[model samples]
Target: MALPSFFVTAGRRWLKLALALGGAAIAQTIPAHAAQPAAPATIRLDYLHTGNATVEQYAVERVVIEPLPWPGNMARTVDDTDRGVNLVEVVDKASGKLLYSRGFSTVFNEWRTTPEAEKTNRGFEESVRFPKPEHAVTVRILKRDENNAFTLAWSTELDPDAPDVLRKQEPSALRPIPIRVSGPSPDKVDLLILGDGYTAGEMKKFEATARRMADQLFAVSPFRERAKDFNVWALAAPTPASGVSRPSTGVHHASRLGTRYDIFGSERYVLATDNRALRELAQNAPYEFIEILVNNDTYGGGGIFGQFSTAAANSDWAKYLFIHEFGHHFAGLADEYYTSPAVYQPSGTRIEPWEPNATALRDPANLKWKKFVAPGTALPTAWPKAEFEAYSRDIQQQRVALRKQQRPESEMSALFKRELAHEEELFSRAPERRTVGAFEGANYEAKGYYRPQMQCLMFDRSEQFCTVCQDAISTIIDLYSRPAQR
Candidate 1:
């Protein structure tokens, strides 16, 4: 019914600043308008997701009552956007009414597509959180079948009042500092920025980096235009070491979050494998979205929709990495570039992807973004594909050689700058540079899949989101916060 008292007790300076900005204070947990009902207690279900490419299984580990109240808008409890590889649905047991539902992708789903999944079975920890219900409910996880339609994969009945449910927990040593407090949590999108691999001496640096990244996120639209619809909170636990593990480089260090580079053996792919450690620390704050900042200067980051996104806080291109990876985590936008090597094996069959950006273009007449297409524009829009691929191939080789040679991070950063310059020059001369039409080479394939534009943040290091991507992101913003006034 109230914000955890530690928020005020542990961060006095931030509390005072929040109050000065007329943001909600700890004592004023509810909105000033008393008519709004208090948010329900937050409930988290921890589970183990295990399997290989051929088979999978899910099992409930435990249910927890998070310290903070639910931060989501009660008015909009069901997700209609239809993104992600899996969906979580909570149904009232007695009446069979759907009380809450959300779509999310997991590390397991990403892993299953890799070659390793074919050889051996492995497991990943996963968690789903919702507002606690008064009575028994059926929690079902639906997975996409071969046809890309949702099919029930696992289900369990849960009772919130059960004696085994964890109703309390020890207070976390880390306390959330209010970075940008727009309003009450339920009325705004609460984004929690977490820091990993920062020592006690570097906590101040971590906060500054988190603040900078949050600012970078809002500098882009529609986040820029709808900035008032969100709140930002930051928290970090001190680590014994200063940087996270980069196994490929033979550098290893322990951190509160088990985040490390060389995920799936890709040098620049960073991710936290320990989901339970992440969830435990995050429960201390009221958050709907999370972005983890790792204390490393390497060019690496990873994101999974509805889980979390990670960015290198000390990279030369940290701002771009932060916003670019956040695009995947925040809106379920697929990667548009294809030249870079990835861990996942190519799919033999092309099914229409559920992500908002890329498409198989199976039905050109009814392209998902047809409304944005110009009247006479070609379905598979023309672009300089041949030339672009030729150039990208050379750049990819240089990128690989730099990492293989153990070159300095600055050299890699310089190469990226040059690559972006070439891309911009190439795109400028193209006839359909600004056109909203299907461009070949997307979703990590040189053919079959198409993106909506010639260049976008998802496609390259460019700063702007494509028109189609902007629309997709706005839809999600509206779902979590109040819709824009007509």
Candidate 2:
């Protein structure tokens, strides 16, 4: 993921200019950042992504010079892992040489799949961040075409020294609490735990919850093995209320990040669409990833790759929620479950999915995760799909009824526990449970799409990731943090 070394001398020259402009003034505002070697200043490009189901467009918003230095390893400035729905390339304008690149997904793209997009157009604010380059750069946004190949969607020219660039930002009263410090910012994966719907008086509780969630996340595989390569920070802007909005229940609260449930009419879904507010709060901390904790007890959460994830901090299944959603946000792992209703409409033609875990089984001879498949394992691996789906249908019905009756959160939690137990017993008996072959019924469809295993965190409330998911996560971990010394 390293950027080409040829631009080192030029990068350093702009790094100095970045420091002079506003980096020096904002130094005192940074919290718990260990002293490290000089790095380039962070530049963010904000824009409006407007579209409907059939068409989309991108327009430039103002550019901003963030308060912090680039928190990623300078050596690993480019992203080779093609995981997200969109890819960004930063190229030197005059030389046309690639300087930096990354893969990420946006709320706008996700919305395009929903039925609402077919009915009416909508716009979402989005942003992309990278290190400041020495020369004028052309920022190109590439999106997946019909065949899942990255095609240029939009491109814009940027000049760092332009007078219109936002060079200064007002200081934030909130200070990020260092939850876990591994090393200098540039050397480790920086994860910012932002809290929404917590009052000023509940800041201590927010920190405790953030720390607990971080511990839970690392307890899972891959992350547990690479725990030392991460730095975790917690921050929250005090809100007047103690919980985020849940429109289905007619409950609403004013929160800093605008996180809430009932996104796209799915009662369990939660997300924050305010990109500006999210970036403004996150800029205070040195972060490459973010997970927002809402101070509510509802079993709701959501994640978008390379952007952020949110979890209901007080939910009984908070641990599962934190890890499962992170799989989507951190590594672009698609959901393996299909019985539950989703906000997105089903695709008429099931081409191969861009996610690492889910596949359309287009080419059985060259399945992406074929290396992990056993020699004699069948291509379309067999499992108790019928039994599992039948049970899931009943459980889903009960789940919907609970929300319809406005049942207590405790009832919802109990129902989930029962569902998990039944799935465990059902999947354990299948001979193919431990096999790594194509399992039918995944990615929100009961047919076409396939998953690598019978069970996984992406598939259900399982405790561990499937082999394919584990490898995918490890790839991302390596991208953000250096490998452990031999």
Candidate 3:
């Protein structure tokens, strides 16, 4: 074994030859990220958005440099698809030039519509993230005025290199599992499917559900067609139990993300109010969008535009909730259903809604989706509203009673199946079922507001999005799937 001097010399000569080649062979010595230019660090401005129905205010909490680089598409720095109630603009402090802007609705905005906000003062911790600039920058948050114009709500200046900015953080042992990776984080839509109530023993079940839901998401049109434009990742921090809190039925468990059912006294509403806890865990993954997976079979989910969405991963209609709630979070689309009870009290005035799918129809001739209208189609489209409302109203009554009685989840699922079957049968016979005409009743209103179609996933448990909703979602898709402009 000690007499192999000739062979050792031959191996050294071969390595020298590879090094002299001066191409991929030489580049192999360096890491891939090192070979490419480093991405800008992700900067998050955490703040308190607090106040009531008549007044609102914002104050800074702290700024943090997230662990991962910005997962957003750098080629398209500006968001052109205007949506949401608020807009965030980042400008160069000294030059006063706009650097980045995005439209997003906060959880506080939704909460403000509820009666609770009218009676009490509450604060919500919200965050706006942007690519870290080299120097100081001004962050401005704008809210819509009564005239529907975006006016400055709050402004603050901060330096990325400031001493107070949090740079170092506790290392996360959590790692993301790739469900479907089409390309690099910046080039594709990076969606993080986070689990909130999975125990260490159920990690594998969480993973399987995540993958299954992700696949079903792609099975829908648009997403199915544009499947290659996305990268899906799943990550879950172990919890002490397997299901999230459901206070209505006296079922409670300690959850890592603070996600729970019965949000705002609505038994079927699920939400996580703790933004910091959610962000801390999500920061470990390269995600531009997050869909929290709650380990429960309850018929509940909630979505806030630009904020994260939650769905009961174990529900019988899990796929429906997964796609529908994501539609709200990803595209800022509003609910098109109205027969169901909502926690939010309606504002006295019926101003035009900002959502792309729903409209006030103040000027029907100039409808937002007028282009899709057939030549002879009515502006205020007529449908079997009376009969449909009669059926839906009865279903709503049954729904409330079932929850009041603390009925089994299987009964709820069966009721949903019946409701869907009735809706399908009812709509299938209508002439304007799939038409692009405006249908009265949407945005939690039986009057004034109108949706683009008679039935859509946004409106009901239908399988497809309405034409207008499809276009609206596609616009957002293009925003994320920015063409290589750089």
Candidate 4:
């Protein structure tokens, strides 16, 4: 059977680069013996699949890279400039033939560079797709830099005759268990919200916040125009009771926390929750997207294609968080700013990003969005620092006021139950409303980053969706629902 075209191109490139490098080294090291025949390099490949099909799909979506450490002291230090490994081939372990290969730059600690500092080890990670059952695989790495003449990094072998694991991991095939919210299958989009840190008694509080978020989502594009076409599954898993006794107050001190709370920070937590939620949504309703409702007010959220989740730090800003995060989930929109810490390193100066929207296109002729941009829209939208500073101060004051006002517990419960119309009204009339120019506090940088609209729900504490955001949401919905053209 023929391998994929990408794999073929990658393999050829790897072979060419390896041969050239090896030839150069041999000519220098043993000039007299260079004419003698050299042995062909031996390569091996392997595949390691976690026993869950959903997890396998999630892994591919997240771009998990499994590292293959070089054996022996090939170089003086792991970070040596001249030291590197080239991925030669990805092959089926059951058969010795190559399935895929690529000639790509291998950085020592690429993951820790910028965006990835907080997430992974500062080491090499190659981008490889997750394989299905009977597809046992191995990747071949050639260490050909000045330090190492030749070495095989790692490989895997699998028993193809064994029973398949995918069948058992499929959620629909598993026995059904009772879960929240079942019914008449409206054409409604299913929104899944994962809980972060709400205590046992706080379930209602979280639920109300989630409902408000759902309302905000519907009020915006895609969901807004199609309000009745949606249902929300708010998963309020109580934080384990006996984990570690810490302060009951909302303020969390890092010192006294234990394993349960600590696990929330793990990548595993994010992946597992996402997989389960997506599976359930897929099995149930039309399953539009998944949203995670975070409990803390620290202000962080993430989204991916076919998935949208958000957290409500405080009841007041629930609308803003919901809409802003949906931008990422709905649109493959790149974060406009580069300041905040991220999970993946900014792929350094060499290769351009594959995201449709953002790019460091220094050349105006090659800009990806040049066609859509108005002829006069500046390449870098300039923001006056003085204006931004004033805006920041006003936003800070509003945040302070929102945090200080401790609504009665009953009111808080009502807020969670979606019974409080006053709170929604308050959000609509927020003082941060500005009809013109760029408003700060979006994407990342409070200054350089400006959202496309003036007072969008993504940019401000409002329930209104800006025209640009609305269009984006609509496009995503169409993409998800549209059938492939012949």
Most TM-score-accurate candidate: 1
Quantify all predictions' global Cα lDDT against the true fold.
0.88, 0.87, 0.84, 0.38
Q: Which stretches of candidate 1 lie over 4 Å from their true place?
A: 1-34, 484-486
lDDT of 2 at 16: 39
lDDT of 1 by residue, 20-76 (tens): 433455336433444444467789999999999989999999999887777787667
Q: Which window of 10 residues has the lowest lDDT sum in candidate 2?
A: 13-22
For residues 303-343, what per-residue lDDT tens digits would candidate 4 score against the true structure? 44333444444635456566766665555454543333344
TM-score per prediction, in order, is: 0.94, 0.93, 0.92, 0.46
At residue 169, candidate 1 shows an lDDT of 92
Candidate 2, residue 438: the lDDT equals 98
Instruction: List candidate 4 stretches off by more than 4 Å.
Output: 1-189, 198-206, 226-231, 241-288, 297-308, 337-367, 370-386, 389-469, 482-486
Cα lDDT of candidate 2 equals 0.87
lDDT-wise, the better of 1 and 4 is 1
